[model samples]
Target: MICVGIDLAAEPAATAVARLDADGTTLRLRDLHLGADDDAIVAAAAGADGVGIDCAFGWPAAFVEFVSAHAAGRMPETAPTGKDGRRPLAYRRTDVEVQRRTGRWPLSVSTDRLGLTAMRCAVLLDRFARAGEHVDRAGSGRFVEVYPAASLRIWGLLEPRYKVDPDARAATLDRVLAAAAPIGTTASQRELMVRSADAFDALIAALATIAHRRGRTHPVPGHLGEIAAAEGWIALPDGGLAEVLRG
Candidate 1:
C-alpha cells in the first residue's frame, strides 16, 4: 500500500510531504517534499492509496452556527457569543475528544491561527472530493486528519520538544527510523528530516497513515462519529474511548 502524509503549514514555505510504502511488516519512506504549495501537495499525493493531512478538516459546529447567524444578519459579525455563554465555538467537539483520548490538547482552529491551516485543508479536501475522492471521516478512509505530535505521544516516543531542539530532533528521527528498521532511507531523506522539522512531522504523519491502513488506529466512537464526520476528527493510534461532550 502507498500512503501520503502532509505536514501542512499555513505558509507554503513550512509545509512538507512524505510518501510511504507499506508492505505488511515494514513501512518505507519512498519520497519526501519540502516547501510545498497546494498544487505541489496535490500532485505529490496523487496515486497514493491513502493520505494523512496534518490539519483540521472543518469548522466547529458552534462556529459554523455562529458564522451562519452572523451572515444572515441575526447576530453581530464580531465573534458571535456562544450558546453556553462562552466562546464554545472556538473549539470543536472532535478536538476535545482527541484531547481526552491522547492527553494532549490540539490548538483551537476557530480561536487559534491554526484555523488558517484548516482553511487551506478545507480547500484541498474540497478539490479532492470533487475529483471523486471519498472520505469517511470516522473510519480509515481515503483521507484522514493526522496529528503527528499526538501520534508520537501515543507511541511512547518523544513529543513536542523534538521540533525546536536539534539534538532531540535528530534523536527522535533516529528513534522513528529505527522502529521501521527494515525500511531503508536515503542519506538525503535523513538530512531533510534532521534539518526540516516539518519534514520530520510529515514522516510521522506517513507512519500514522500506515497505522490507519493496517487497522492499528482507533475510530471515533459511534455516538461521536456523526459529529466527527461533520466537524472533523484527529486520527491517533488505538487508545481509550473518546466522547463528544467536553467538560
Candidate 2:
C-alpha cells in the first residue's frame, strides 16, 4: 500500500513528508521542508493507502486535557487506560507543559526502534529534493513519534539495507490504515498497496526536520511499545503521561 508519514510542521502548508509502501521497506518518496514542493509530492503519492504521522492527529495536548477534565468532548474516541497502575493507555508521544514550563515529553521508545530509521531516510531525501536544510526540524508533534536523535538512529526514509523495528511500526500504523480504509478516503488500498501514504509523508518530513535539529541521526530503540508500557503515565510516579496515546 502507498502510505505516508507526516511530521506535523505546526502548519498544514509547512508539514514534512515520508511516502512508503505497506511493508515499510520500499521508499516511494521522502522529503523534509516540503515548502512549495508539497503539492507535487502529495500528487505523486495520491494513491497511497495508509499514512504514519509523527504528530497528534485529532486533539492536541491542550484539547485532550480539556476533554479529560470534562471541559470538552473526547476527541480520540478512546479513553485513557490503566486505572490501577498495572495496564496503561498509550497514545501518541508529544510535548507538554510541566511545572509551569512547556516542552516536556513522556518517555517513549526512541525513534530508531519506532520507525525513526525510515523517518530519517525521508529527511535526507528532503535535502536531496529541495536541498536547503541539512538538519531535521523538531517542531511540536506527537509525543510518541518524536524523540532525541540519540533515540532514533535512522536519518531518512530510504530503507537501510535493513531495519530493527521490523513489524512494530508497520503493524501500529496498520491500525490506522485499516480503520480508514473502509471509510473510503482520498486514497485507497487494493490499487497501490500503500497505506497511510500521506501520514507517512509528514512522518518523513518530521524526521528530516528532526535531523536538521540534531547534527546527525541514527535508528535505535526498537521496542517503543514496551517502553510505553513501562513508562506510560499510569506506571509513572504520578498522574503525568497517564493519558498517553489513548483516547
Candidate 3:
C-alpha cells in the first residue's frame, strides 16, 4: 500500500511531502519533496491508498456560524462570557479533544495564524472533491487530517522542544526510526529530516496515516461524530510506532 503525507504551509515554498510505500511488513520512504506546490501535492497523492495532511480540514463550526452572522449583520445579542464560553468558537471539538488527551493544544485553526495554511488545505480538499473523492473530515475516507506532534505524543515518541531545536529534532527522528524498525530510508532522507522539521513532520504524518489505515488510532466518539465531521478529526495513534509497521 502507498500512503502520502503532506506538511502544508501557507505557501508552496515551505510545504513538504513524503511518499511512503508498504510491502508486506516492510516500509520504504519512496520519495520526499520540499517546496511542494498544490499540483505537486496532488500528483504525490495520486493513486495512494491514503493521504494524510498536516493541516486543519476546516474551521470550528461555531466560528463559521459566527462569521456568517456577523457578515449578515445578525450578530448574537450577547458576547461569550469568558474563555470557556468562547472556546467553541475558537477551537474545534477535535482540537479540544486532542488537548484533553495530550495536554497540549494543537494550533487553533479558527483563531491562530494556522488559519492561513488551512485556507490552502481547503483548496486541496476541493480539488480532491472535484476528482470524485468523497472528502470526510472525520477521517472515514482516504484523505484524513493529521497532527504530527499529537500522533508522536500518543505513540510516546515526541521529544520536547523538537520543533525549534535541531538536536531535539534529530533525537526525535532517531527515536521514531528505531521504534519503526525495518522501515527503510536513504541517508540523505535522514539528513533532510534532521535539517527540516517540515520534512520530519511529513514523514510522521505518513506513519500516522498508516496507523489510521490499520485501525491503530483512536476513533471519534459517537457523541462527537457530527461535530467531528464538520470540524475535522485529528488521527491520534493509539499504539506504539512498531505496531504501525506490523503487517
TM-score of 2: 0.28
Any runs in candidate 1 off by more than 4 Å, and if so which? Answer: 76-87, 239-247
| Candidate 2 worst ten-residue window by lDDT | 233-242
Ranking by lDDT: 3, 1, 2
Instruction: Report the Cα lDDT for residue 210, model 3.
Output: 88
User: Best-fitting candidate, measured by TM-score?
Assistant: 3
| Number of backbone collisions per candidate | 0, 79, 0
> Candidate 2 or 3, higher lDDT?
3
| Superior candidate under TM-score, 1 versus 3 | 3
The sequence of per-residue lDDT tens digits that candidate 1 reaches over residues 85-176 is: 54468777777877787776688888877978888888888887888878665545689888888887777677457988767889988777
Q: Model-by-model lDDT, in order? A: 0.79, 0.32, 0.90
Candidate 2 lDDT over residue span 135-226, tens digit each: 21222111223331212222111232112333444543344343323223233322222333334445433333323222222222345333
Model 2 stretches with alpha carbons more than 4 Å out: 21-33, 36-45, 58-247
True-structure RMSD for candidate 3: 1.0
After best superposition, candidate 1 residue 134: deviation in angstroms? Answer: 1.1
Instruction: List runs of model 3 lying over 4 Å from the truth.
Output: none
Clashes of 2: 79
